[model samples]
Target chain A: QQQVKQSPQSLIVQKGGISIINCAYENTAFDYFPWYQQFPGKGPALLIAIRPDVSEKKEGRFTISFNKSAKQFSLHIMDSQPGDSATYFCAPYRDNAGNMLTFGGGTRLMVKP
Target chain B: NAGVTQTPKFRVLKTGQSMTLLCAQDMNHEYMYWYRQDPGMGLRLIHYSVGEGTTAKGEVPDGYNVSRLKKQNFLLGLESAAPSQTSVYFCASRSNREGQGALGRANVLTFGAGSRLTVL
Candidate 1:
């Protein structure tokens, strides 16, 4: 049913520019949102996460802006680098049935130098 | 700590073949998970274990089975391999902490490199 939907199947941004990925969820039960970055041949790694209580959370150059009413969240990476070129996934946490996570399709980002 | 590690990083099987994937964690985590990643589909949970001797099914559990006989190891078995079963498998583990307020919450999952499987 696609509980979480992400936009821009692929993104290309210039180095030092801002890279943003957005996601929206249909379930209000979701309280936690996390972003993951995955390199080829590797599993996804936690990048940043935010709870619905906060409208925004920033970690170093990475930031997560969340809107509870809209059920949307976005990840912003400042000063995007070529090394940042990889696949990004946004996932929402809904622990109803069990400790299960619902993930978005994915966004492939390319930061060109 | 070697964190979470999956055995047989790569495997190839034919239809009707059966195999088991082993996942071991050195961190003594209470929760372990098995997920599969496809081309367009992101990571989909197949099975998970909250503790030793307890296992639960995830989003896609058909044609698959899992066991957690020991706290440090989680095994996933495919009774019959099919072409649709081809994907990259990942194992993750997390520990419980206070203020997380529940089991398997507020903890980041440490994932393994991944295991690539091909079914002919």
Candidate 2:
């Protein structure tokens, strides 16, 4: 069974627009939630992350809005740029689980110049 | 510094052939992992090691084996390659001594450039 689900397999937005990707997880065992960004020919990298205790966490133009009660989290990219066009994944992890992460179906984002 | 490095960035193999993908980390981390990424499927863990001389199966460990002979090296081996195994494999590592705070970056994973394997 898919423990995590992500919406909008693909997305396209203007350079100045906002790009949002949402994810829902079913595992209550998860505590640390992180989002990863992947560029073609490269491996996924850490973008930003949030814990269940916080409702939101932002880093520069990237923000992670989390809803612990809803078991949902979303990534918001403000002023999306062409350079930000890439695949994004939401990986929920449990610390005691040896930090093993369960990834969601990836969202391919494309920002037009 | 090379945080994490994967060897043979690209390879092609025939069914039933055996091969090994090597992962090396210079971060002195105590944990290492192997994950496979497929189109629209995100990333799936194949196996992982928490420390040298110890390995554990992950969500999709079948048809794959892993060994952590040294603190800086983790090796993933395929006894018999299959077409279904064709995918981009990633190696990631994190320090086990990271901060214990719930919101700490201990869960952060630093990944390598990845190895693309094609089985015919």
Candidate 3:
């Protein structure tokens, strides 16, 4: 099984502050990195994703920064709000037939008012 | 559309009891998966099916059995529930159409609200 390491098991940020979560993968074969957000008692939903071809991809207040050489990717949330508080997971996959997506430990984010 | 629906949102079973979790998708997806989410351990795949009448074991498939009799439905069964099996189970589905999305067709998975199961 491929190992996925996520940082900051937990985080706390003030409203309007930036919240960052990191993920490191050991497999270079992975071509797609996606982030999922899960609120309490709810299933995870796709938040954002980035292909290895691009270094960074941003949508609204969320951004995904990828580093091919480093085999790592990070999610940055700018001006994060209390509504953004949730558990985030980094799921990377090879994007090929029969390949299963690997998920990280997850980072719990708490945004204070 | 009820993307994916899981039955028995919450269930409690005795250690030796048996129960099955049903996952139904209305999107006509060909691929379906069953995953168990544990605290601090992330979600681990228990079983997955690429099409009807086919099933494959995943990372933690020890005491779980899965069957895909219909394209839109996947069932997970536990012969005998155990305390270790207490966790949240999630069902997800994806389309088989290629080149449907920019990131690729197999990258996205629409998950169900999840079912909470506990074995006493």
DockQ of each: 0.45, 0.58, 0.51
Among these predictions, the greatest DockQ belongs to 2
Give lDDT tens digits, candidate 1, residues B3-120. Answer: 8899999999999999999999999888889999998788888999888999988889999999999999999999999999999999998775432532224667789999999999
Q: Summarize candidate 1's per-residue lDDT along A25-107 as a digit string, tens digits.
A: 99887766889899999989988887777788888888999989888999998999999999999988743333766578899
Evaluate residue B43 in candidate 1 and report its C-alpha lDDT on the 0 to 100 scale.
Answer: 84
For residue B59, model 3's alpha carbon misses the true position, in angstroms, by 1.4
Off by over 4 Å in 2: A96-99, B100-104
For residues A1-113, write the lDDT of model 3, one tens digit per residue.
Answer: 78899998999999999999999999988877899999999999999988887799999999999999999999999999999999999988765445555578899999999
Question: Which of 1 and 3 is ahead in lDDT?
Answer: 3
Residues A1-113, model 2: lDDT tens digits:
43889977899999999999999998887878889999999989989988787899999999999998899999999999999999999988775456556688899999999
User: Which candidate ranks first by TM-score, i.e. highest?
Assistant: 3
Off by over 4 Å in 1: A94-98, B99-105
Error of 3 at A108 (Å): 0.4
* Candidate 3: tens digits of C-alpha lDDT, residues B19-117: 999999999888888999999888898998988999988889999999999898999999999999999999998776653345533447889999999
Candidate 2 whole-model C-alpha lDDT, 0 to 1? 0.90
What local lDDT score does residue A15 receive in model 2, on the 0 to 100 scale? 94
Q: In CAPRI terms, where does candidate 2 land?
A: medium
lDDT of 1 at B58: 84
Ranking by lDDT: 2, 3, 1
